[model samples]
Target: MTKLGLEAKDLEPTRTIFHSIVSGFSCSPIGRIRLDLFGDSSHFRREPIWFEVVDLSSAYHALLDRPALAKFMAVPHYAYLKIKLPGPKGLITVTDDYRKSIESARDGAKLAESLVVAEERRQLDRIVALAQEASTAPIPAEDPADKTSFKPSKETKKVKLNPEDPSCSKYVVMGSRLDNK
Candidate 1:
């Protein structure tokens, strides 16, 4: 495995390993342990969390030459010296950018659905308002010769219904249906 750079004490602080696979190679981020022997536990404990390199596809490696491949293959499993970078103090998390974009698209679709439902609700309310207006508005006066002409009246007619009759009791009067004496 030494040919593949796997050796004793091969493990070290802030080191990354590129595992050779049948298809290609895969590597992860390298991090070092904190050596705060004299300090408190806050600075002593450490976790092994590595962030994988981005866009390291098989097609990308296929484009590289022998010398370049050998150089990359020789990378030590651990960092030989002190390694420090700016930004995140702990392990850096890496994720697929394409996946993130897909999630954002799904969120946008859900928002669009909700907006469509709201617009439909507003349309229904408008139709209901129009119906109410049509019901209460005064009818236009017709020609005196029109036999079908009917006059609008504010007076409501009361119908005498037998309380003991099942048919009359079961039926409910609504609007002007019972108002035309």
Candidate 2:
């Protein structure tokens, strides 16, 4: 492979190893953990969860079976780290631009809500002003036709639903027939 920078092979064994460990180590907001750890229908949907890089290499070395870690990885895991990022919850990440984006969303929502509220208040103020004018205005002498036209309708209508397919109640599915009613 073509060498870049100081060269990949030139990296110290320990430094290279540390970088590997750091790359694998991850953090996550608790909500993601509860989604995975708790379950699909879990109640703690919005909680923050945190995780840290485990020193598993140390554990393997302490066990005097360093190769076992690889073997352990071979087994199918009923429970395993989600590990990857961005699909709802796997790892925690932070960046200047990402934080700014989150803040921007919150600020934008608040600004929108405030603007809506202010407009609603302005509308209410106008309505109040109109009400005050109407209350103070001289009442017009009532016309006879005005009283008759304001009456509520006393007529009633009946609506009935026809049974769906009298020939086949068992096989006829509900939503397929749009004209049943």
Per-candidate alpha-carbon RMSD to the true structure: 21.6, 22.9
Which lDDT values do the candidates have, in the order given? 0.41, 0.37
Candidate 2 Cα errors over 4 Å, as ranges: 1-96, 144-181
- Which regions in candidate 1 have their CA more than 4 angstroms from the true location? 1-96, 144-181
- Expressed as tens digits, the lDDT of each residue in 106-127 for candidate 1 is 7656655665687689999999
Q: Give the candidate number with the greatest lDDT.
A: 1
lDDT of 1: 0.41
Candidate 2 lDDT by residue in tens digits, 32-105:
11112221332212323222222232211111122432322222221241211222443332222444445655
